[model samples]
Target chain A: AQSVTQPDIHITVSEGASLELRCNYSYGATPYLFWYVQSPGQGLQLLLKYFSGDTLVQGIKGFEAEFKRSQSSFNLRKPSVHWSDAAEYFCAGVRGTSYGKLTFGQGTILTVHP
Target chain B: DAGITQSPRHKVTETGTPVTLRCHQTENHRYMYWYRQDPGHGLRLIHYSYGVKDTDKGEVSDGYSVSRSKTEDFLLTLESATSSQTSVYFCAISESGQNSGYTFGSGTRLTVV
Candidate 1:
């Protein structure tokens, strides 16, 4: 069974401040990792994904994630956050065999303040 | 956006009544999934369809059933609504592959009284 763990339940940051959201996964093999964002009353949107190459994967809205195989972690990072970036973030992992089913972690709610 | 839409954006129902939620997609993706989102639990998959008339149970599929008779539609049915079932449901679509990113619908909020 694959599981994703997000340590932070909520985080607050000022506008233009750096942000990092931690995520850890437990899977037997090399897993496919992804980050998704959801606003209130909206569906989730994919931020980025990590398949194999490039430990650091860049995503939309100036978001990026680093897949650290050693630590079993994929942490999302942004140099500067905007107020509009306030949303819920989820980390998910998929085994190589499963077609589309994703195991998602408890999301981290991000609050961006001016 | 993958053209996925969930019907009855908001629904209020009584317990013991049957409720069916519809998920329609214009992208014609091969994979469709039903998930429920609750406070603190994030999103948990209830069911998924790989193709027309082919479906599978997900992690939290005990009280739910699903059907996919066409390529563009997947329906999730709760035989008997329970107060525990009140939550936001989301529909997602993905292409036929392992690495494809999922596209999700806005979501349907169902409240059972």
Candidate 2:
């Protein structure tokens, strides 16, 4: 069974500090990876996706993610975090042979402190 | 957001009552999906439709059912709601299944008392 794991349940970072949210997956083959952010009282928005391209992918709001095949990981990163960046992040993916079905991680609640 | 919409943004109903949530899309996507978002579960697929009248169960389809009678509408129904079924439900659409990513709606928050 394909699964996504976000090890950090919650992360607190100082505003203007660098941030990294870890994400790992388990699949027999290469999968389509994505990062989504959900702000309070808002729908989930696509941050970035890794299908078949450069390992380093850029997304909205100055966010980026690196897909590491050997490590089965697609981690989200930001060089300088903003207070508005406080929100829940989810990592999702589907097996190479699968359809539009997505396996999502447990999500990480990010809190930014000024 | 613009293409997809969910009705009854929030609702409270008694346990054992039947509740239906509506997902409407104008993007004419070929694939539609229903998922439940819980505190610790992130999002779990309840069901999905490939085309009109073509549906399939997902990982968590025990207490839920779905129907897609038209290209623009996908409805998710809870036959008999339960307290444990209280969750925020999201609807997503994809222009191409498996090959493309999905667009999600604002979500419907359902509370079963």
**Number of the top-ranking candidate, with DockQ as the measure:** 1
Which residue pairs of candidate 2 clash?
none
Alpha carbon lDDT at B91, candidate 1: 90
- Give the clashing residue pairs of candidate 1, or none: none
Most accurate candidate by lDDT: 2
Tens-digit lDDT track of model 2 for B1-113:
99999998999999999999999999999999999999989999999998999999999999999999999999999999999999999999998866588999999999999
Q: What TM-score fits each model?
A: 0.98, 0.98
**Chain A superposition TM-score per model:** 0.98, 0.97
Provide the overall lDDT of each model, using Cα atoms, as 2-decimal numbers: 0.93, 0.94
Please give the clash total of every predicted structure, in order.
Answer: 0, 0
Can you write out model 1's per-residue Cα lDDT over A1-114, one digit (the tens) per residue? 789999999999999999999999999998999999999888898999999989999999999999999999999999999999999999998898886788899999999989
lDDT of model 1 at position B63? 92
Q: How close is candidate 1 to the true structure, as a TM-score?
A: 0.98
DockQ of each: 0.79, 0.77
